[model samples]
Target: MENLAKKVRSKKLSTRVDLTAMVSVSFLLIIFFMVTIELAKPKAMVLDSPDHGCCDCPSYPDYGENRSITVMLDENDKLIYYMGLLESPIIAPKEIKYGKDGIRRELLKRKNSLLKYSSKSLKPESIIVIIKPSKKSNYGNLVDILDEMKIAEIETYAVVPEFTPEETKLLAAN
Candidate 1:
């Protein structure tokens, strides 16, 4: 019995736990978390403003009854003017050139047309110009158009984003 007890006590039980599988699982979990996480992007905001007393207000109308003249700047910085509002047929300027003088000439012609259509006592202030520049349009061309609008004495102008309703909603939500 003493010999048997000695043998039993001397024998060691092997119980080694392998950590390789655990380490691999941990690595896979880390990789999955890194892959699934979404990075945030910066966005701009649009706000509704009262018609009379807000600075930096969006060019959209409150009652949807205001007159708006839309001018489009294409990807090539080409100026395309539309009289009236959105969904109106795009009207081409008499001449197509990418310069300040050309824009001024076109604006003058448009002003004259407005005068011809309206009563002689009406001022150009009744018209609201809306500039719709393409995403890839040249900044310089936009500046030129702005200058022309100023020269034409158009004070109530708006810069509208060239986006669809869904895109606008997405942007607004963000």
Candidate 2:
């Protein structure tokens, strides 16, 4: 034990690793990537507006009789739909439940009618639907309506901000 103690000498060894160069190289790599990386371009959904943005453009009649279906989204997930013009004597706003027997059925019925009444050359895209989401409606309501439109296989549908005052009154009355 005494010979081993005599043979042992106390000496300090530096175990510190200098990470300054490593950190500097890592920061340089990070900065290089940050500077060279290209920013991703955001994709947006294109929405069609009613106004053409040109005053000189010839204006069509209030209702073109293009055989459009007006789907009015009311509060509490209620759907009020009318065919053709809103004021047409034959067409009145009818509240229907949402499902197989709901808006999809109505749209299918209208689509079949359109196929029957319209020229044989006309395509399914000719069946236009105007979705009007009231102020009381929310994002989920709009999404549901859009989903229903897709489920019904409607190709041409426009989202309108508001409905006419008379339509509002009709919705309230119902």
Candidate 3:
């Protein structure tokens, strides 16, 4: 009876030993997986500009390919208040003041034009308002323009840097 009890205790010890090896292997696998995991990288959009010695001009895309509206901010950071499609003649600021009401009215006019052109197609959720502020422009002006764009429902937009392609290329080359 003493020998039989000893044998039973031995069996229990063997089971416990087997569980220790499995737990150790599981911990090693968790550490290996954590070390081998790759972190996500940030994404950014690249803008193509002209090479060296090129004139300072915004990259003009093919006409009517994509509907875009350009709003120029002067040295004072005030809006030029133009009401026209990209690459088309810009209406002078003297004709329209650079106020919130004026911007809202112009946006509505553009929306009306798009509706007339694509009556069967789905209405655009937002208009692409490209802002190009002068180098000497105030930062507050840019913020104001963004706020105005949001209020006018023309929130989908891009900001063109004041430096031209040639300028950027020169800086890069130097």
Q: Which candidate is the best by TM-score?
A: 2
Residue 86 Cα positional deviation in candidate 1, in Å, after optimal superposition: 6.1
lDDT of each: 0.60, 0.78, 0.58
lDDT of 3 by residue, 109-168 (tens): 876676576677564333566777767668777777777776776645667866556333
Q: How many backbone clashes does candidate 3 have?
A: 0
Report, for all candidates in order, the number of backbone clashes.
Answer: 0, 0, 0
Pairs in steric clash, model 3: none
TM-score for candidate 1, residues paired by index: 0.46
Judge candidate 3 against the unseen true structure and give its global Cα lDDT, from 0 to 1.
0.58
The Cα RMSD in angstroms, rounded to one decimal, for candidate 3 relative to the true structure is: 11.5
lDDT of 1 at 68: 51
TM-score of each: 0.46, 0.66, 0.47
- By TM-score, the better pick of 1 and 2 is 2
Residue 136, candidate 1: Cα error in Å is 0.7
Q: Model 1 off-target regions past 4 Å?
A: 1-67, 85-95, 120-125, 164-174
True-structure lDDT of candidate 1: 0.60
